[model samples]
Target chain A: MIARRIIVLLLLLGALAEAWPAAQTLVLVVRRDSPVTDLDSVTVRKLFLGVPVLINGTPLRPIRNRSEPHLDEIFLQQIVAMSQPSYDRQILNGVNRQGWLAPSEAASVTRVAAELNANPNAVSFMWERDVAHNPNLRVLRVLWSD
Target chain B: MVRLTHSLWVRMMSVVLIILAALAPLLYLGVSRIVEDGYQERFINSVRAYSRLVADQLEALDAAEFERRAGAVLDGVVLSGQVVFAQIVDGERKIHSSITPALGAASPREDYTFGQSPDQVYYISHQVRRPDHAVVLRLGFDEIPTSERIRATQRHVLLAIGGFVAVSIGLALWLSAVIARPMVLLQESAKRVASGDVHVQLQSHSSIREVAELNLHLERMRQELVGTNEQLTREIAEREASEHKRLTLERRLLHRERIVALGTLAGGVAHEINNIITPILLYAQMALDELPASSDLRADLQRVVESAHRARNLVWRILTFSRQSDTQAPSTVFALRAPVEDALALLRAIVPTNIEVVFRCEAEGVQLTGDPNFVQQVVFNLCTNAHQAMRRDGGRITVTLAAEEDPGEPQLRPGRYGVLEVSDTGEGIDPAALPHIFEPFFTTREVGEGTGLGLSVVHGIVESMGGLITVRSASKLGTTFRVYLPVAVALSNAAGAA
Candidate 1:
């Protein structure tokens, strides 16, 4: 009876966790003059992680969402295939080396995407629908699938 | 014996009261300003903290919750009779809630855009931030009652000032009286002293040291003044007595000199009278014994009577000189040369054969106003002295008659005076003997040869008639004697008073 009660408690905990709202990815967005067309998963990862962030022989940067920490976690896990433990270690190492960037909110990320699409040397990210009106930034599909 | 009050004390007290009254308002203002400054410091600190606490709570809650919480917080704050109002606003100046009952449910957001009221009102606004929105929390307090309280404070201040002024005035009045009382006494004492009461003095032991010292000094002055007054009185009495003694001595000396002169005159007159009487008696007996039975023996008897009458006239002249007994009224005017002529006639026989006499008289020229006897005496004495001086040398005498005008060095002014000068060319008086000639008993001749009262008697007669006599002589030059007699005042007023 105790085992049954433990199983039921675990089930209830999972159900409560699943009941939480899902957080969306924080995409990298840029202007149409951006040189990126076929990007590698590592390069996209490097850009989001603020490493080797040059695009089309010019420097680019990433934008982020500040809605929830879970959103950042989910984007790093699903898109960058980073586990929680490894991500914390990477963040700690980057902080120790003084090489980290803070995340931005959803409205700011879209604003960055619009500003970046008009410039050849800029890079930022947003949801796909958010960049639909901007003709400068082409979708740079990575070879890896989640 | 009088009681007195001092005036300085009253004056000093009044000065002190006036000084205190003048300073009252300034002192009150200074003290009240300090108290209000302290209150303002404490109030500012409490308001700052209160604004911060409310701002934090407002930022943490939603709009509805903020209104409820702010209302409750304002209700919870307890003020000690002071009014307070509180409100909350967003950064856009939108009012969320207000604790002021007078403001009602109205939103005065635009009114508070500048945050502070312009009517010298005191309010505190603190900004608070949340994840979603920023808000402003505000608190205010009314200053009308504070101003009224400040005004109310004046009542106490006025009471304090009044108390100080009253006390100061009272003290001043008391002090002035204390000082002025003795001074008033001193003034009265001074007045008494001026009126010749030197014995008055001020009492001692005044409230002020200076006043006490002054009183002591005044007492000393009084003692000194009394002593001085006594000394002056004694000196004045002694002086008056001494003056009286001197006057008596002068009178006695004058009387003895007159008696001696009278004795000399009496002997001369008695000898002449005896000689004249003897002759008269001898002539009368002869006429009676040798009368022709029917002859005119009447003529012989008449001659004897005439000789007797001449002797009596001479006796009268001597008596007049000796006694100065004539008291008849003075003549209005007479010729200056008449008395000299009469004196020359009296001495005609005594004048030597070699001496020639001359007389000059005008009808009314040299006029004088004096007893004829006194004038004659003055002339006779001088003529006799001149005749005796000339008899020794058989010299010539000149008698001049003129109105004296600029008579000599010490001249009398031009006026009517009869001047008779009997000048002798022989035996002029020495310079040394001239001054003493007018002094009684002073003579150049041997004591038996002359009676020295002649010039002195001349001086007396001339002075009694309000005239002056002067003599100038030298060893070889005959002496000149000028006599000055004043003209009468020449008005009827003088005769009226006389």
Candidate 2:
């Protein structure tokens, strides 16, 4: 009976693990030396979608990450409000019109954070927990919470 | 009306005006259509660009942020003077707008289209897509201003057309003058020719070939007419000269016939007078012989015998003058001065003292073959006629006897002859009576004053002796009678053969 109870508890724990999502927080981050202190949701969305957003006459440069599919999906759903393929086509159109394009895809979260830390005007999104201990990066806004 | 139709200027102007009238309206309509089409295209492009700008701005915002700034965004579009009543609506609800209307009021069609409101303002509407909703943008424009611009352009085009037509008419008139100038000159020259002035010369220096050719032909005709007129004038002068010569000959023939008729009548009358006179002369001479000499009765008888002898001599003279004597007396050669002197002496006693008689014997030794009494009678009768002619304005009488050769008298043969001329300064014979002066009983004197037979008898005596007579007279000038007698040598030779 004690073994059967332990098996049930383990099974219930697996179901609970499957039922609850992982703790995922999308944060808008920039270099610590950036003039921007904070951004609204609309401004952050505008920046990712290749739309130019200026803070005190300074343009924000956005960076994208390719290593985390889950974070990318949440950002696309909350900020871009379009499918991945649709957003890619929009970016292509923006490139043809001589607008700004996302830089090279970041290889990892550390690389994304490092790119934000290197450029004062650069902006990107990452998990809040991953950036929590870093002092070299700034949290510009919260893009999504799950 | 007739003159107006004929004017070249008028006709050319009319044709130009008609063409302008026909083309003016068509040009206006085509220009107006092009202007309207171009303006409409430009207006549509501008409105579409405005709608696109509004859509891009709205699309970049969240629903909540769009609500906060929609009014400001739309107000900026409306202030651009291209839009009116811009609105952002989602489904049946209005989020923001330039102006508010009742909810659920149907928005205009969102596909770019034009409409007119009740106030007569023109508006265009377009639908723009936002992230969560569709926005309706209505743009109002004042059509009156654009229409006014179009009308002003139309008026300028019309004025330009009118100015062109006026210039064309003026050019047409100038062309007409250039073309018709030669014709006007030709008409004037032709009028002069018709009025008998053929000397008019037309100008041949014309630009038109036909007009120059016509002028050349007219010049040739004028030369021909001048030649014909000169020929006709010469012919007329020659005809008049011949006509005058013919009339002179006709008068001479009529005069000769009258003299011959009177001679025949005088011969018969003289024969009767001679027979009666012979018986009275014989009886008176026998009575005178019986009476003695040295007694009173004897002297009276002697006077009667002498008177009877004188009467018998007068009868014989009349018979000879009338050409009725049975025995013809032979013509004798005598000094022509003797008869002329004798005639002047007798005429001086009978003429009025107001008349002066002068006798001239130019040929003192000139001789003639004719009866001396007959020569004396011709001189006496011519002088007597001269004295009678001058009785009204008593003037001079002249008797001249001379010898001439080839006197050119038609009846006198071409030889030396004695000429007796009698002249008087008097009221001369009338030209109407000159031809009839030798006719028997054709006298200008009053009745019973003198016999018209005096000149006829003188003509017969002169002609029977182989001589001729002619007379000339003029009014207020004088009278002259010439009697031509044959020379003694020529008459004797003529008589010897006869």
Candidate 3:
């Protein structure tokens, strides 16, 4: 009984430790052929928060990563710097008032990569480690780093 | 019918029902509250989660062509079974689901909890972020599922309660039987005993000690009562026999005294009658000597003398019946058959030929210690009375002479006796006249037909000897006279009458 309880306790602590945010250098990515190379943190935040932005006469659209574990939470915490509800609320406000479209969400790494390559203005946030093996995608800028 | 209101079974059932009445409401209320709250919380939480999801979709909509696309988002919310109404509220702008019902009747009221609204709808709102603006997304979830679930749970609870109540009543019935069975049996048994049927022994079918003990006591009491009743019955019978004996003795004594008084009076009357009739007889004989042979007056004179002679003989018989014998004549043991046959022969000659005199003597040598003349007279008188009784419709006069070894009467000494049974198939003596039959001059015949002294003389003759006389007669049936006399045993003054 003691051994089983100790194992369960260790597992729970591991999960809690994993759940705590750690310093990560999150960068915005786009297709290598895209015109956009870097964006300032302020514009990146507004774009991710459902603000309508255009770069070099092309409409900028943000794509959110859904399938990556805890990627949305980390992005919201570091880049958006807002709670999930607050972030969603800001985006919905812009859509309702200006009739603007909100950011699109992709469910997998390949899906995010596909969106980035297809749309030149499409940008998405992910850990830099995930972008390393995808040669077709390039980091536009460091979205956040500890 | 047993009165259920006062019965043990009813009492037991009442207690069980009272307990159920007390607990059923508490159980129903407690269970209903738990089910309602659980379903309510679950419903509110689920509706809130679905509303948040709809808000998420609103926030995720693309800005370009947002108007056309947002309509699809709202319609999707309406398509989901949980939400019946969906809308987005922005400053100075409102967007409702295209498929939502027209709400011109009433605006949706937001619900804080699942069951807080009467519309069976739980309304909630979530804010969605938009570019420089946040919009409120309101969703109304249908609460029917939660309400139906609660109702189903409550039905199950009610079924459980009902089952419990049924089982309790069954148990109460069984318990009441266990308690009331012995008492009911005892009560029925007690009723039978009260109705005087105590032959059945009181018994206990109860396992309870007190009931068994009570039965034992009651059984003892019943036995005691039976014994006491038996003793009282025996005492009553014996006392009745004693009273009858005393009355019989009194009657016999009174009859004897009357006979004695009548004998004294007859003796005196006979002496006077003899003196008067003797002179008349001598004068008539003297006149007859003087009368001429051709004279008709001679015959009439002769009748006067004849009647005078009859009066003389009657006075003589009266002397004998009155026991005016100079000294008590020596009573001799004699052949009973000879005298009985002689009396019957004389009776046959004198009575109507239709009254056949039949004599039977079974005891050939049975001798009685009384005077033979007394037996002869007794036979003559009883036979004469029988002859008179049957004069209207003549019948057989049977003279049965048998030697009785056992006395027929209880007052008689145990000895050999000659029972002379003289039975006549003739008109019987009246029952009202039966008691006075042996008394002097008491007869059913008309005065000119009989002197009514036949049975009186017979009773006197038997009593003077050591004997008893009993007569049995029924109206229109027949008359029988049984005369029992001691055989060859001198018993003086043995007078008994029946």
Candidate 4:
């Protein structure tokens, strides 16, 4: 009975590990009414990295989490194809060239979702699991696969 | 009482102190004012920059994010212990602050304002605009630090002013010494000069030109005084030597005058005595011829012999009067009338017949303490001068003798005097020559006609017998010589009886 119970516990632990999201999996989202339904990898990278992007004659505004290490790593590695420091440098360079703020930063996922709901041209990144509860937001692009 | 205000040092120091006293407060106020202005400008600018920075940060944030990070933002902006307080206020009366909530409850209504509390804290409030609220950033600065800075600057200014005043006083004292030293030395030298130190020499090496010139003038005056003193000494010595020589010459001249008087009297006496002696000898021979060798008529002839002897005795007395004695004879009480009569008798023999010789003895029995020969000689000399003076024009010669009591004569003391006055109505002595008439060899007569010793010898004889002789003469007027002899009081009664 002990041997059978140990085998069952190992199977349950493997299933729970399989259900969690990968460390680099981040989903780009926008308001449900936004004209930008989907974006190419280059367009998504340019929009989030402080470069101006337009879809269907409407400009896109970028949003970010203020202090989420996992999302920042995923976005820098999968979309920008640069290290975190290099990606930050690219964002600062784009801000200097464009003569505007790079992006609006939110303190948490709820704040990021609310920012996106309020602005139809706004864009942000979050965990795939958290996007299910935000009904006013839509997934624009997936940054990395599990 | 001497006043301190009159002192040069006091006056100089007072002026310096008054100027310094007025300047010190002004210097402190000026320095403090400049420092306060500088500190106030810097504080206002710093406060303005801090307020603008906070307003820009707030404008960029949403209401929810701003609410979440407002405390952290104020904490980041407000330096510990430097910014005394800081605050932010929302429209619904929700206030956030680094300080206590009660302290930051009211936002300043104005756009910008400054306030200071009694506790020496300074507050600068700035209004900021926001999307959902109005924010106020009230920053407090403790005034103690700024005040301390201003006070430090004032202290430095006071120290600088104090040093300047001290230096000015030292310079004034040095200048006063430089000026007063030479003046004090000059005053001392002048005092010595006033005290008759004519040999004082002043140094002419003063740095000031006027002082040096004054010293030069003082030295010149000293030299003049020395020269004048030396000249006066030389003149006094020369005058004394000249006076001694004059007195010696006067004594020698007096001796020569005596010899001249004796010589002049000897010739006249010899002629008169010879005339008397010839008659006596003739009478003796005549008597001898008229008498027999041994007759009774010889007794009558004896009377002629006695008369001849009396005539010879008179001749011997006339010869004795002409001689000068080496030693002074002792005085005796003698009747002044006798001397006057004897002098007249001698004068009658030689005086010309045209010149009347009158003798009046009004002093009846007045006696004098003097040599009889000297008295007679005085009368004879005066009569001889009178006779010679009148012989040319044949005028009258009057000899009068009188007794005087307390005669107020300038040359004679107040006493009873036997006064003998001889007057001649002849050519008078010149007014210019009157003062020297009694001097030996001082004569107005021709060389052979008269010897100058006549009046001088008369003056000498009268003075030696304790008498005074005075003469009064004028040009073309008659001359009178008056002799005053002191009366002999002891012999006056005896002589009066005789």
> What lDDT would each prediction earn against the true structure?
0.59, 0.70, 0.78, 0.70
Give the candidates in order of DockQ, highest first.
Answer: 3, 2, 4, 1
TM-score, cand. 1: 0.35
Give the RMSD in angstroms, all C-alphas superposed, for model 4. 24.8
lDDT of 1 by residue, B332-446 (tens): 6655667667777886768896666665553244556767667777877887788788776676666666554444423244444556666767678887776467665567777
| Poorly placed runs, candidate 1 (over 4 Å) | A1-146, B1-22, B56-68, B78-83, B91-99, B102-121, B241-498
Q: Which stretches in model 2 have alpha-carbon errors above 4 Å?
A: A1-146, B1-137, B163-388, B394-435, B438-441, B447-498
lDDT of 3 by residue, B1-498 (tens): 458688887888888999999998889889999999877756654565566556666767777756787778888878877778777777667888888775421456545555666788766655455666666667777889879999999999999998988898898888778778877888888889889887768875778888888888888999998898889989999999889988988887897788789988987898899889988999999999899999898999999999999988777767666766443558677888988888888887899888888888787777777578788889998888888888878999999988766664776887678889999998788888887887666767766877666777677678777688998998788999999987774432242211
Give the Cα error of residue B101 in candidate 2, in Å: 11
Alpha carbon deviation, residue B7, candidate 4 (Å) = 3.2
| Per-prediction TM-score to the true structure, in the order listed | 0.35, 0.42, 0.51, 0.39
- Measured on C-alpha atoms, candidate 2 has an lDDT of 0.70
**Which structure is stronger by TM-score: 1 or 2?**
2
| Tens-digit lDDT track of model 3 for A10-123 | 999999999987656667898888888667555776788788778888888899988765676557544564556556777888899878789899999888988988898898
- Docking band of candidate 4: incorrect
DockQ score for candidate 2: 0.01
DockQ of each: 0.01, 0.01, 0.02, 0.01
> TM-score per model for chain B alone?
0.42, 0.48, 0.62, 0.47
